[model samples]
Target: MAAVETKALNGVKLKKKEHRNAYATMMYMGTPRDYEFYVATRVLIKSLVKLQVDADLVVIASLDVPLRWVRALEEEDGAKVVRVENINPYTGQQKRFKLTLNKLYAWSLVDYERVVMLDADNLFLQKTDVLFQCGQFCAVFINPCIFHTGLFVLQPSQEVFKDMIHSLETGKENPDGADQGFIGAYFPDLLDQPIFHPPLNGSNLDGQYRLPLGYQMDASYYYLRLRWRVPCGPNSVITFPGALWLKPWYWWSWPVLPLGIEWHETRRQTVGYAAEMPVVIIQSIIFLGIIVMTHVARPAISKLYYKNSDKTTSMMQTAIKFIEIWSILAAYVVPFAIIPRTIHPLVGWGLYFLGSIALSSVAINSFMLPAIQVFVPLIGIFGSLLVMAYPWYNNGVVRALAVFGYAFCYAPVAWGSVVKLLARLHVSVEREQFFPKLTESSPPSGVNKLC
Candidate 1:
């Protein structure tokens, strides 16, 4: 135990001997969208190579990360990729942050004498090799005396990793619901350590294990200046501490902080900007065509039907009404087409379901249009009853209950549609953009009225 402690403590200093050290980061690409982390991690490695850092660069990534990305890290960037099984135990309100447990696994890489762990969102501005010499569990102060886990140095050991797992298994609560909170609790006095370093070539150790404040500059501080504080750089790395959405890869973020340009340039070189965006463009085009056809073609056809019909005037009017209603309902599917790639799965499915319902309703209305005005209310009531009661008769109680419960949920939508239909019945049609009103008295310009 004494020797273990001594070795662990000795690993922290910039001793005059060759030591196995690594600049490490953990990435969890659990979903397709998480591929952004792969891009960001690649940028970090690019920065390391560009600066000619001496230590080994290592990535501890989730097993789900694509093999090609792992290969790129190893072959292109010359970094070591350590794939690990992601065991997520946090299941509280902050379930999203549960993946931070993957980051804690870095302490289990017992091969490295000392490891400097960084978050994937960090951008290296200057060579941060000096962090390698820092003491065990050294980190920058987030608040007055609280350590920020975005960038930190520590001795890797099986014992620490086991203890972390044990703590979690034993129900040790982490207020932050992530690695930073667990770490802050584990090493409460981490702030007492020496500050990482002073500005290039400034001074020596002050016996404190803390790193210099500049090593992990609060990116939010760059924008808000909450305390009216300027960046105390020459910063070694800039850590994006808040929302991942604020990261530099997003083009819209350019106006707020041009730092994203640096990240974008790095990405363009490594992965290139030609990504899944083109698919979104194709989808946008398809939806645009649908919108144009709905506005132009459907109305024209409806107007023709209204003009040509002799004894079936009511039937023609119903067809025209169906076209107008169906076109407006179909427009719901268009908004999602703009950024199809980024939309949530549930939301995308919702729009799809809505358009399908609208199309089906149009089909039914076209067949029963002249009679629909009489049966609309009955159809809704009987439809609700059949949906709920059929499941109950078959002894599928859960399905029946779900059907019954969801019926009331649609009351608002049904009421709104009823109101809208009534209003449309009372008002005369116009030759406007969406609701084109073509009356016998006043038809479209240069076009005869449908008599």
Candidate 2:
């Protein structure tokens, strides 16, 4: 115990024993799949080292992490690995949450006097070791004014760990099914306190410290910083939270996201960079093809159908038809491609459906009734499916069978729609030819034909 204290004392003398600081993170895959945790951790440690952080680096990983990753963390990154058993705090109602409950183990890392616990997805832009001086439980505010758990300062204690476990076992439910909710419940008054840090708090330098807003920036903020001139220059760390798809490591995010560049920088240093522009180009081409098919191709085909109809095409009619087609394209493209950046995706979709219904009402009422609406749509559906399925056929016999099957389904529907449209046109022509004469013909009102 004396020897242990001596080592602890030496660590303290190096950076102030009571002020010993470390950056820690937690990882638990829960299920087997490709994840960005290892790569993100490597990048994070590298960033800290680059910034010359005067602190120990630690990662509390669940034992489920592969042996190779454990070695990478210890041997390659020079991080202390604290392996713990995975536990599921959520059982009955929220069993699937599996909300990295193992993170609570960070509180038990008593070796370090103060630790800045970070989410695996956090990337440091500059030195944040100054955060070690902050008081316990400092975190930046996210939505609804709650301090985000993504990056926070906390003092480690076995007592706090035992208390948290006690709360968990005693059915003290965490509404968010994660450490954030539980920690928030424990430190509800943290928001009310005046935090030190004159740049962040503007007044307090002697009291507690609140996390600066810039430190836990979401990657989306980078876009705002670019376009709208939002401040991002002073930020020390950036946190990638919300959804898995939003992470920078994914290949699809490379084109527009700034974090993609950061991720690539880390990869180039740690794992040697591979040229992914070809892959990105191919993906972009495929995505563009889908957009063209849905917007430009579908609308152009509908316009051709209208033009080929056996009716006198007037200038007004042509203009209306163009408007109708443009509306369809707008309905398909605007909400998905444009509006989601400004507002919620669900709201965008609502606007899309509403606009589509309003714009298509005239077209639907004019032809859909007599044109066999159900059959026309069925023909379109099967035709598209057949076209998509055509490239997959390898065998001649199977290809022939599929072609026959598609023809069998589509021919009748097409024929029915054409026949119905022609009959309706014929009826209209007959009515136009006779209606004027009937109106012009005078009947003898005085003479009773019945008599």
Candidate 3:
């Protein structure tokens, strides 16, 4: 181990040593993709390549689409692309890049000794040569430090793969979450590493970081430290990424990313319409509940919640805030809905699901629109009663629930529909722009995004 460490360290100081140590950054890509997606990653790649011609780096994008996007990635200027397929061993779900990035990194999918796993959705706003400090074993920021299950820097070796796989088997996970819980739980400190970088570099797209050095560790330590406070001034890299597996517009609220379109295509291939109807039923209930709660319930009670009539907008905003819980819930539910259910009538419920999304255009809630579409329904009855007890809720809110309740009487079936329709829409998410209509020939005006 000492000899191996010495050899790896010898190559780190120079950019292009004769025996150059590899330093890789990871991300996945797909075909018929948003040009903006690669465009954004290019910003980071350009910075890394500028640091050295022989930086020993490439963007690791996953391939789950039938539309070969490899050529498109090759066509991109100033990028070295490696395509990976995220084959979910347990579920056999191939379209799960978000859940599998860390697995890829831990598996040493790239050649470099140091691998930085970055989300393609993030922009490299500034230079970040600092990530090179953690030589081998592992290199990553630990703020809010769980594996994040998305992005990081790694000292790739067979050991990481073994440890990660081991953690999953031995580490106690939520069963519902993903590899994230296991990442920190098992590794606690480095799996068997000598020195891992401090999380002060930052973690997640939200730019959440904490404390200073000497005792600097990633958020994993902080999490382990049980909210331990340390010192860290600015100078950390700013990393903003998509918050969830799917983009928001794709009936999944994650982002309207191109992968969902690919998911839709593959579903068609495997079982055709036969397997998709259940998803439609589930989606319809989720959507109907969202529309009624944000549009109807919260707006009606916002003034009361805040005890300030002067701000109807405030009421709208509060309504939206309360509804955010539902959106978050619906997000949690839909991905699991990809499995087929046996709904009596998949067709009608599917239409109801579409109606909720289409009606999501109504801005009665606020400029953000469709606040309740996700918020109210996502919450179960336990919390709903608390919100209802507040006296501020009025008729509009009550009426909205009444209407939603009637429509979603058979919510299980309706929920499947919502998932099915969004799956069919060819939905795509890039940054914050979500165009509801997936197949529109013309792109949305002013919805263009920067990487």
Question: Residue 115 of candidate 1: its Cα lDDT?
Answer: 84
Which 10-residue window of candidate 1 scores lowest in summed lDDT? 220-229
lDDT of 3 by residue, 28-128 (tens): 43423343343345444544444453445455555542234444333543345544444232332233333442344434442454555655433232344
Model 2 poorest ten-residue lDDT run: 221-230
Each candidate structure's TM-score, on Cα atoms with residue i matched to residue i, is: 0.57, 0.51, 0.37
- In Å, residue 116's CA in model 1 sits off its true spot by 1.5
Better by TM-score, candidate 3 or 1: 1
lDDT of 2 by residue, 1-451 (tens): 0011122212222212322678888766654322456666777777776677888888777667888888977788877777666656565434324646676777777778778888777777666565665555566667545777777777777677777776876768577866778777877776666443423322344644444464432211110110111122344566766666556555434322334456556556655423333543454454455444444333223232221123443554445445544544453444344222212222323444433333333333332223233236434543544453454455446656765776787778777765665555454343221112223234233211210
lDDT of 1: 0.56
Candidate 2 backbone overlaps, count: 3
Candidate 3 similarity to native, TM-score: 0.37
